[model samples]
Target chain A: ETAVFQTPNYHVTQVGNEVSFNCKQTLGHDTMYWYKQDSKKLLKIMFSYNNKQLIVNETVPRRFSPQSSDKAHLNLRIKSVEPEDSAVYLCASSFLGGRATGQLYFGEGSKLTVL
Target chain B: QQQVRQSPQSLTVWEGETAILNCSYEDSTFDYFPWYWQFPRESPALLIAIRPVSNKKEDGRFTIFFNKREKKLSLHITDSQPGDSATYFCAASNNRIFFGDGTQLVVKP
Candidate 1:
């Protein structure tokens, strides 16, 4: 069973367009994270939310923002997508403020392509 | 700056042979190290992990060897099979986790 689910498994959009990716976790985990994996397969943390509280922001561009409606849902919105914004966006969830021992559960990932 | 570095961006190993992937980190605060394995079109999953207090951790055929003084670690896959072919990532965390660029491993039968 997939504990975390992401919508629009693949997205293709034009430059300067705004796109939003939705993520939901059925695991009831308190913490959700957004990560971007570039073509080179470098995974970077973009945002982390615990109980709707923004805990970590990795100095991402202002165009990128994360919104959490609740503990189970965390969404990523990108305004004016650029060529560099084309990458795989992954959503993961884990227990809140817990030791790193708990492995993060990840969705298949949403691949974004900007033309 | 890249905190965690993985070597041999790609590796090819024969069936039943042992494959070793190396990784090193620069942050001393990173007390936890985890290895993740990712297959094509799939999300990365935790394979094995080791803490600074332990020198080695083993699960099934996967093992993680850690060296705190050297700030280095390595993953060894014993009796590797073709199914083991995938991209392996090394991640370090103090408070937030950081992943290495990744190492693609191809295991041929």
Candidate 2:
């Protein structure tokens, strides 16, 4: 019953390497998001896209960037990975202003391990 | 500033007992509240939700009690079971969503 999907369930890379995580949602949602969860289980929002338009960008590092091709596909690319970037990157989707509002459907998450 | 906040970073409860998870938010503009649960090694999914218009929302054994005046909410899980053990997240939304650090719940049988 998962409508949101993520690639590279687990990736291990060294510092200064580039990593890209892809996400797609088939729920016809108008919004998508990327969240980083650290080992402490703290979930922090990185970016949010509404209909392929960048809407919310938290205080993430410049090395981290988000891309959106359409309303269904959103991707995260880290230009230069760091030790602090080793965490689970979760992708989620939701609809705005309706019965389904405020409910988020999340993917399995892409776990990044920086060496 | 952290808009949404959850209490008891971790909790342990006996089976068949009622487990209460508390949440509060700083933004009065937030109108939607949803509680999501995540099991180990799995992604989070919506467990229950409530809006400011209603003070309570219930579904089976899961119930959400909301307080618009104090901007606080609580999720009560009754008849707790081992399978109910997971991390519960409280979130507030106003077009943009904000999630609180989850409360890890452990139900002992």
Candidate 3:
């Protein structure tokens, strides 16, 4: 029943390994975002894409990268996973409007575990 | 560097009571405020939202009280039920949205 779909709901890998997560939205929202929820439950914006164009990219580690092939898809890839990289990565989409406040739609999230 | 903040990291209330959650932001340019709630092992969803033009917005049992002058707002859940227990987040944005530390609410039946 999720409008936003994510694959590999849970993943586990050793340090120095690579990992990837996929996300897709059906709401037709032009803007999508990637947020990381740490152990402390703090949600931080990592990246955002509007119509396949990178708009907001936070000061994330170099190992982390985001790819968007279309407006409905946004993917996250970690080149070299670290122990501290264990967290919930959430994909969200929102309608782009200049006058109105954006309301976000989110996926179930992919939980990453690095050893 | 937290622009939006929420008070009382956690709260508890009885069924049929009103639960209030408070939030404040530092950015005056943030005209839109949206409150989202997430249950355990689930994704967060929008509960209610408001703009600076209006001081209050209500939807069924959920309501958002906004104060543009103080840059503060509160979400009031009337007739709280156990099902209403979840983590509530306050967010603000002009172009892009920023989230606040969620407030965990526990409603006892």
Q: Relative to the unseen true structure, what is the C-alpha lDDT of residue B57 in candidate 2, on a scale of 0 to 100?
A: 99
DockQ of each: 0.58, 0.64, 0.62
Off by over 4 Å in 3: A97-99
Query: Can you rank all candidates by DockQ, best first?
Result: 2, 3, 1
Q: What would the per-residue lDDT of candidate 3 be over residues B26-56, giving only the tens digit for each residue? A: 9898878989999988889988899998999
RMSD of 1: 1.4
For residues B1-108, could you state the per-residue lDDT of candidate 2 as single tens digits?
789999989999999999999999998989889999999988888899888999999999999999999999999999999999999999998867888999999999
**TM-score of every model?**
0.95, 0.97, 0.96
**Candidate that scores best on lDDT:** 2
Clashing pairs in 3: none
TM, chain A, every candidate: 0.96, 0.96, 0.95
lDDT of 2 at A17: 98
lDDT of 2 by residue, A12-102 (tens): 9999999999999999999899999998888898998988998889899999999999999999999999999999999998886223578
TM-score of 1: 0.95
- Please list all clashing residue pairs in model 1, or write none if there are none: none
How badly does each model clash, as a count of residue pairs?
0, 0, 0
Please give, for every candidate in the order listed, the TM-score of chain B alone compared with the true chain B. 0.98, 0.98, 0.98
**Candidate 1 deviant stretches above 4 angstroms:** none
